[model samples]
Target: MSKVTILGGSGAVGSIATETLASSGVFSEITVADINFAAARKLVGKLKGAKLSVAELDAENPHSIRRAIGGSAVVLNCVGPFYKHGPTIMKAVIEAGINYVDVCDDFDATEKLLAMDDKAKKAGVSALIGMGSSPGVANVLVRFCADSLLDQVEAVDIYHAHGGEKIEGAAVVKHRIHSMKVDIPMFLDGKFTTVNLFEDSGKALEEETEFKDVGTYSVYGYPHPETITLPKYLKGVKRVTNLGLVLPPAYAELIKGMVRLDITDEKPIEVQGHKVIPLEFAVAYILSQREKLMKEAGINQPMGCLKIVVKGYKDGGKNTYIFSMSSRGQGMGEGTGIPAAIGAILMGTGKITEKGVLPPEACVNPMDLL
Candidate 1:
C-alpha cells in the first residue's frame, strides 16, 4: 500500500483533498499530516475506512517536512499562506525525491518554485504547482482553447470568486492580506508588468463579469500565478490577466478597507499596554465579522467559478470563446481540493512523467482533468 501524505490535512483544503485521494483508491494508505495532530484526528474521525492515518508535521521545519512526507508515493501540499510555506515545503519534498503536488497560488512563490525545475529534474521529481481551482482548472481551460478551440490564441482573461468557508483560518486571511499589499504581476502587450492592487493599475482593469449560475460580480486584479506562468507556455498569446474576488462583495470591500487602512502589517505594535500583530488582529476581526457580513450579503453557502475568455482571429475573422466552471452548494473543498488530489494521483501513477516543476497547463492533460 503506497502512502500519501497530506500536509495541512486538518485545514480547509487539506481535509477534502485527503478524502478525495482516499476515495480514488489510488493510494492504499493516506496520512493526514498537520502541525496539530488532534485537529487532524478530528477530521479523520469522520472519514471512513482504515486507509487513513494522522501525523504531526511542523511545516516550517525542514526535518519535520521530510519526516512527514518521506516514503509517501505523492505528497499533496494543501498547506497555505503559500507565500510562507509553499517554497519551504516544496524544497523539502524535492530533497526527499517524492512526487509532489501543491495549490500554490502566490505568484512570488510560484516563481521561486518554478526556478527549481532543473533541480527537480535531477531528483527525478514530477512536480505540479497551482493545481487548485483558479490556477489549476483555469490553466487547463486555456490549454484546451489553445489546443482544440482556437487557431490563434491572442488573449486569455481569467476571473474567479470563492470563499465562505465554514471557518476562516488566520493563514488564509494573511495570504489574502499579503496579496493586496504586494505589487501584482500581469502580462500585457507581450511583456510582464507589476501593478499595485490599490492603485490606478488595478482599478483601471476592474471587471464586472457574470459567472454562469453564480451571478455577476466585480472582480479586481489578482496576482495568481496563471498570469505569470501561462504567458510562458502559451506562446504567441499576447495578454493574460487574472481578476478575482472572495465572495459576498461586502466581504471583498471589507478586506479592501483593511488594506487601505494599512491594518495588515505583520509587524507587532503596542496596543493598550500589550503587543499585537496588526495582521493577526485583522484576521481575528475579519473572522469575527465574517458571519454578519456573510449574513448581510446573503451568502449562506459556498459558491465559486472559473471563467475564462479566449479571444483571437480564426479564418481571418474575429473569434471569441467563453468557458465557465461554476459550482454552488459545495465550495473550495471540492473545487480546489479534488484537483490537487487528482494531480497527486497522476504523479503517483506515473501518468505525468514530466520531471521538473510544471503547471497544469504544461503537464496535465485537459481531457483527463475534465
Candidate 2:
C-alpha cells in the first residue's frame, strides 16, 4: 500500500496521470496537490477505487511542497515551466526522504537537477528527471540500442512532434519561446557543441523517419535533454542531436514570428505608464490564437510520434535500429502523462533501483517500461 503524491495534479498531464495510476490499482492512496485546491478536488471526484485527497501546494514554495508531500511514499511532479518550480520541489522531495519523478523537458532544469545527484543519493532517494516522452522514451531507446543492438554507437538522432490540438497554455508557449532563445547543446564531432535554434551548425543526418500513423514531416534540431544526456551514457556515441516540429506550416510560421520578435523576454518593460513583460504578452497572444489554429487545421484531436534512430554496430558490424512510439488524442496528456504515471509506479514498486538524479534511460529498462 504505497501512497503517491502528485504536485500540480489538477492540470492536464497531472489529471491524466492521476486517473492512469488510480486505474492501475497499485497504489494505496493517491493525493492530487495543486495550487488550485478546487481543481484537485474536481479531478479527485472523477477517480474511483482509490483513496484520494486534495491538497493546496505551491510548488514554487519549499514549505508548501514539504507540506504537500508529507506521508507520501513517492511524488510525481507535473508542474510546468520547470525553470521556475523544479529546484524547489526537488529539494522538498529529497528532504522528505521520498522517491521523486518529474516530466520536465527543459534542459536547463535537467542540468540543474543533475547537480543535485549527490544530495539525492545522500538522502537515499531516487530521482528520475525528464521521464516524459521525448526525453524519457528517447533516452531509453538510445540505451536499448547501445546495450543490446549496437557495439560501437556512432550517432543518435531523436525526433518528436505533436499535431491536432493547439495547446492553449501561455506558460507552455512561453517555455517554447524561451527554449528557442537559448543556445541549444548537442554532441558533435566527439565533443559537445552549442547551436542556436534553427542554426545550421550541427551536422545534418537526413532521416526518413516514419511514425506509426502520423505522416512524416521534416524534423530539424531542437535543444532537448537527449542531446546532453545521451553522450554521457552511450560510449563511443560521436554525435547526438534532437529535433522537434509542429504540424501545419502556419503554426511553425507563428512560432518563428514570435521568436524573431524577441517576445519571450521576462524582463519588465514600461508601457503606457504601466509595467508589463513581453513574455506575458506573448503568452496571451499565443493562447488567443490556439483555437483559430486548431479550427483552421481541422484538428479536434491530436496525434504525434517520438522516433529515435541509432546508427552503430550490431553483431560486431554496422547496423541501424529505429524505435518509435506513436500516440493519438490528448497530445500532451497521453504523451506526457502516461510516462510520468508509469515512472511513479516504478518508483513506488522499486523497479527503479537507482538512488541518484538520473534521466529515464539511465535508470529504467526500456523493455520493462514498454
Candidate 3:
C-alpha cells in the first residue's frame, strides 16, 4: 500500500502539496500531519478522493514526527524556515527507514542534510532535499540543459518572484530575515564564494528582470541551495546564481528595512520590563502591514513566476535556454509545493531509487520530473 505522510500538511505549501499528492491517486492512504490539529483537519476535510486522515504532530519532537509517519511508504516534509527543523526531522525520518522528501531551501540546511548522506545510505533511505521551486525545478532544468541541450554548460542563473498569498506566516518572514542576515553562497568562476545581502557584494549582482506573466521586478542575490548544490552536479560550469524577490517590492523592502534597522536581532532585549526578541516584534509588524502593502500594489490575489536561464554551448557554439512557469492566481505555495509533491510522487512510483540523502539534481531525472 502506498501511504504518504505530509508534515506541516496544513501550511500554505503543505496544503497544496497534500492536495496534489492525494489527488494523484497513487497513494492508498495519505496523512495530513501538523502541529495545529484543527488546521490539519480543516485541510483534510476539503479533499474529496483517496483515504485522507489527520495526525497531530509537533515537529520539534522527533517521536511525534515518527508517530505521524507511521509505516508510510514516503514522507513529504513541507515544514518551513527549514533551517530550524530540517536536520532534526531528516534524522528522525532516516532512522525510521522510510524514503523522504522535503522542500528545504536553506543553504545551511541543505549542507547539513547532505552531510547525513552516509547515514541515510546506511539506513537504506532515499532522502531528497531542496525539492522546492528554486532548488527543485531550477536544479532539474539546469540538469536538462547540461544533459540534452548543451554540449558544455557554462553558466546557470535562476530567478523567482512570488508573493500575494492570503497570509504570510511567521516562519516565512523568519526565513527572509535569516536570508538577509546570513552569508549567501553562490558558485562563480568554477569556485564557491559567499556574499552578504546587505553589502555591495550582493547589490552588485542585483538587476531588473521581467518574469513572464508575473511582471517585471528588481531581483537580488538569494541564499538558496541552488547556488551551492548546482555546482556539484553541473561540473565545469563557471557560474550558478540564484536571485529572487517576494512580490509588491515594498514587502521585500520592509523586511530589508527591519534587517537594516537591527530590528531582526534574535537576542532578547528589555522592552518595558519584558524580555522580548526584536525579531518577533519585527515579524509581527511586517505581517500586520502585508495586506496594506499588497493592496497598494494592486495585487488582489496570489501571483508568481519561476524563471531559469541556462547558458552554454550547443555544438561548440553559445546557446541559451530560458524556462518560465508562472501563474496569475497562485504563488509560492503552488510553485514550491507542487514540485515537492512531484518529488514524492517520483519516490512513491519507484522513479527515484538511490539510497542516500540527495538534492533534486543528483537523483531526479529531468525528463521524469518535467
Candidate 4:
C-alpha cells in the first residue's frame, strides 16, 4: 500500500492536493498533517476509500516532521512561506528516507534545497521542488518545448496571474512583498542579470503576451525559480523571464503601497507599547480587508492564467509554441495544489525515477501533468 503524507495538509493548497491525490485512487492511505490538528481532521473527514489520518506537525521542528512522515512513501509539503519551513522539512524528509515534493516558490530557499541534491541522491530519494502552477507547469512546458518542439531555443517567457479573492496566509503575503523589494536573478542579453519586480532593467520587451482567454495585462518582471533553473536545464537559452500580476488595480495598488513603505521588514517596532512587525501588521490589515476587497472587485469566482512561450527552431525552421492553461472557481489552491499532488503521486509511484533535488521542469513529463 502506498502511503502519502501532506505537511500543511489543512491549508488551501494542501486540501486541494489531498482531494486530488486521494480521488485518483493511487495512494492506499493519505495522512493529513498540520499544526492545526482539528483542521486536518476536518479535511480528512471528507475523503473516502483511502484511509485518512490526521496528525500534528510543526514544520519548523525536524524531529516533529520526521515523526509525521514516518512510513510514508511520499511527503507533499504545502507549507509556506517556504523560505522558513522548506529547508527544515526537506532535511527531515531526507533523514526519514522518503521521497519529497513541495510547492515552494521561494527562490533562495530553492537554491538551498538544490544544494542538497548530492545528499538526496546519496540517500536515494527524489526531492522535486516548486511543483506549483507557475513554477511547476511553466517549467514542464519549457522542457517539453526544448525536448520536442524547439531546437536551440533562444528565449522563453512565462506569464502568470491570479484574479479573485486572495486567500493566502500571512507568510505568503510577506514573501510576495519581500520578492518585490529584492533584486531577483534573470537571464537577459545572454547573461544573468539582477532585476527588481517592478524596476525596469533597461530591457525592452513586447507590449504584451496574449493569454488565451484572459485579456492581456502589462507583465512586470518577477523573479520565479524558472528564471534561474531553466538555463541549467535548457542549454543555449539566452533569456528567461517570469512575469506575474494580480487582478484588480486596487490589489496591485495595495501591494505597491506595501512595497513602497517597506512594510515587509521583519524587525519589530513598538506600536502603542506593543512590539509588532510592520509586515505582520500589513498582512493582518490586508487579510482583514480581504472580504471587502473581494466585494469591491466583484470577484466571487477566482481565476488564474499561466502561459508559456518558447521560441526557436524546430523541424529545420523557426517555430514558436505557446502552451497555456486557464482555470476558474478553484482559485490558487486548485491551480497550484493539483500539480503539486501530481508531483507527489509521480514520486510515490517511482515514475520520477531520479534521485536528487530537482525542479519540476527537470522531473515532470509535461504531457502527463497536463
Candidate 5:
C-alpha cells in the first residue's frame, strides 16, 4: 500500500498539506499524526480521498514518532518551531529508513539536518528539507533562473508577506519571536555574514517591497535557511537575502515591540500569584490582539505573495528575472503547505531519486514543483 504520514498534520500548514495530498490520490493511505488527537480527527474528517487515520504523535518522543510513522512510504513533517523539533524529528525519520520531506525554515535546524546527508544517503532515504514557501518556492525560482534564464547568477533576493489567517497559533508567534531574537544570515559580496534585525547592519538591508497582490510593505531581514543553503547551490552568487513580514503593519509592530521589550524570555516569572513564562504570555497577548489589529488595518481576508528577483548575466549581459506568486484569499498556509504536499508526492512516486538530506533547489525541479 502507498502510505504517507503527515506529522503535526492538523496545524495551519499541515492541514493544507493534508488536504492537498488527500485530493491528489497519490497515496492509498494517509495518516494525520499530531499531538492533538481531536484536531487530527477533525482534519481527517474534512479530507475527501485516501483512507485517513489519526495517530497521536509526541514529537519529543522518538518512539512515538517512529510508531506514528511506521509503514509509511513517505513522511511529510509540518511540525513548527523547527529550531526545537526539526533536527530531532529528522533523526528519528532517518532512523526509520523512510523517505522524508519537511518545510523546516530554521537556519540552525537546516544546518543540523544538512549535516545528516551522509546518514540519509547511507540509509538510502531521500530527504528534502526547507520545502516550504520561502525556501521551497523561493529556492526553486532561483534555480530556474540559473538553469533556464541566467548564465551566471550574481544575486538573489527573496521576499514574502502574509497574514489575516483565521487562527494564529502560539508556536507560530514564538517562531517569529525567536527569529527576531537571533542573528539574521545573509550572503553578501561573496561572503556569508550574519546581521541582527534590530541593529544597523540588518536595518541597512531593510526596504519597502511591493508584493503583487499583498500591497507594499517594509520587509526586514529574515534568518531563513535559504540565505545559507542557496549560496552553496547557486555557485558564484554574490548576494542572497530572504526578507519577509507579517501583514497588518500594526500586528508586526506588536511582535517587534514584545521582542524589543525583552519580555519574550522563556523562563517563567511571577505575575500575580502564579508563575508565568514571559514568552508564553507575550505570544498569548500577541494572538489575542491579532483580530483587532487586522480589523483596524482593514485586512478582511488572508492574503500573501512570494516575490523573487534573480539578477545575473544572460548572454554576458546584465539581466534580471522577477517572479511573484500571489493570491488574495489564500495566505501563508497554502503558500507553504502546497509545496510540502508536492514534495511528499514526489518522494512517494520516486520522482526524487537522490538519497541524501538536501534542499529544494538541489532535489526539486522548479518546473516539476510548479
Candidate 6:
C-alpha cells in the first residue's frame, strides 16, 4: 500500500498536513507519527479518508525517524524549529531510501541539507526541503519571475506577515526565537552575506509594508532559506531578501524585549534549586501576553500574505512585477501546511524527477506548483 508518514503529525502544521495529504488520495494509508503517540492517534481518528494510523517517533533519534518512515512511499516532515531536526530527519529519509518533503525554512539547516546532495543521490531518493510558505512558495515565485517574467532578474524582495493562529506550539515559538537570535542570510550585490536580527545589519533593511487582506505592519529581516537558495538558481540576481513578521506589534516587541534582557539564552539555569532554560521561560512569558497583543492590534482572524517584488530590465527597459498571495481566515496551518502536502503529493506521485536533496526553487517548476 502507498503510505506517507508525517513526523510531528500531532502539532499545528503536522495536523493540517495530515488532513491535506489524506484528502489527496495519493496514499492508501497515512501514518501520523509524533513523539506523542496518543496525540497522533487523536489526529488520525478524526480523518475519514485514507486509512490512518499512529506511530510514536522521537525525532532526535535517527533510528526512530528511520523506523517510523521505514516503509512509507513518502515522508513529510512537519516538525519545526527546523534548525533542530531538519538535517537529521532528511538524513534518515535518505537512509531509509524513501522520497521526502519538509517545511524547513532555516537558512543554516537548508545549507546543511543541500550539502547532503551526494548522499541522497547515492540512496536514489528524492528529497525536497524548504517546502513551506516563505521558503517553499516564495522560492517558486522568484523562480517564476526569473524564468518567465524577466530576461534579466536584478532583484527580488520577499515580504510576509502572518498571525492569529489562535494557539502556537512550542516548536513554532522556539523557531521564531532562533530566527531572531541567529545570523540571517541575504543575497546582496550578487553575493551572500549574514546579518543578525537585532543588529544594525538587519535593522537597516527593516521596513513597513502593507499585505493584501492583512493590515500593514513592520517587518524585519527573517532568516528564511529563500534568501540563500534563490540566488544560486536565479543568476545575475543582484539581491534577494526575506523580511517577515508574526503580526501584532506588541508580540514582536515582547520578543524583542526578551532579546534585550538577555533572557533568550538556551542554557539551563538553576532557579531556587530548580532547573529552567531562560529561552523556555521567555517563550512562556510571550505566550501569556500574545492574546492581549493580538486584541490590541485588532487582528482576531487568521491573516497572512506572501508578497514578492521583482525588478529587472526587460527589452533593455526597466520593469517590475509585484506578485502577492494573501490568505484570509487562515494562518500558518493553511499557508504552510497545504504546500507541504502538495510537495509530498508531487513526490509520492513520482512527479519530482530530481534524485537528491534540493530546495524548491532548484528542482521544482514554479508554474506547476503555482
Q: Which lDDT values do the candidates have, in the order given?
A: 0.88, 0.82, 0.92, 0.83, 0.93, 0.88
Writing each residue's lDDT as its tens digit, candidate 3 over 1-370 gives 5899999999989999999998898899999999889999988998978899999998899999899999899999988889999999999999999999999989998899999999999999999999988889998988888888998989899999998998778999999999898999988878999998888999899999999988999999999999888888887899999999998999999999999898988899997899999999999999999999999999999999999999999877999899999999988889989999999999999999999989988999999998
Residue pairs whose backbone atoms clash in candidate 4: none
Root-mean-square deviation of every model: 1.3, 1.9, 0.9, 1.7, 0.9, 1.2
* C-alpha positional error of residue 225 in candidate 4 after TM-score superposition, expressed in Å: 0.2
TM-score of each: 0.97, 0.95, 0.98, 0.95, 0.99, 0.97
Which has the greatest lDDT? 5
RMSD of 6: 1.2
Write the residue-wise lDDT of candidate 2 on 1-370 in tens digits. Answer: 8899999897877888899999999899999999889989988998897799999988778888888889999999989888778888898899889999999888888899999999999999999999888888788878877777777899998888786653446556766776777888888889998886655653253344566667767665676788888888888789988887776546766876888788768899999999999888877887677767867977678888888888997777889888778877657677888899999988888899999999987899888787
Error of 1 at 83 (Å): 0.5
On the 0 to 100 scale, the lDDT of residue 88 in model 4 is 86
lDDT of candidate model 2 versus the reference: 0.82
Candidate 3 lDDT at 111 equals 93
- Candidate 5 lDDT over 1-370, as tens digits, reads 5999999899999999999999999999999999989999998987788899999999999999999999999999999889999999999999999999999988988999999999999999999999989889999989989999988999999999999987778778988999999999999999999999899999999999899988999999988999998989988999999999998989999999999999999888887899999998899999999999999999999999999999999877999889999999998899999999999998998789999999999988888887
Please give the lDDT score at residue 27 for candidate 3.
Answer: 92
| Pairs of residues clashing in candidate 2 | none
* Model 4, CA-based lDDT: 0.83
229-327 per-residue lDDT for model 4 (tens digits): 999998888889888777754776687688877876789999889999988888888767766776797777777789888888877888888888887
Q: Looking at candidate 2, what is the lDDT of residue 201?
A: 59
True-structure RMSD for candidate 5: 0.9
- Report the C-alpha lDDT of model 6 over 140-196, residue by residue, as the tens digit: 887887888789999999999898996688888888888888888899988999988
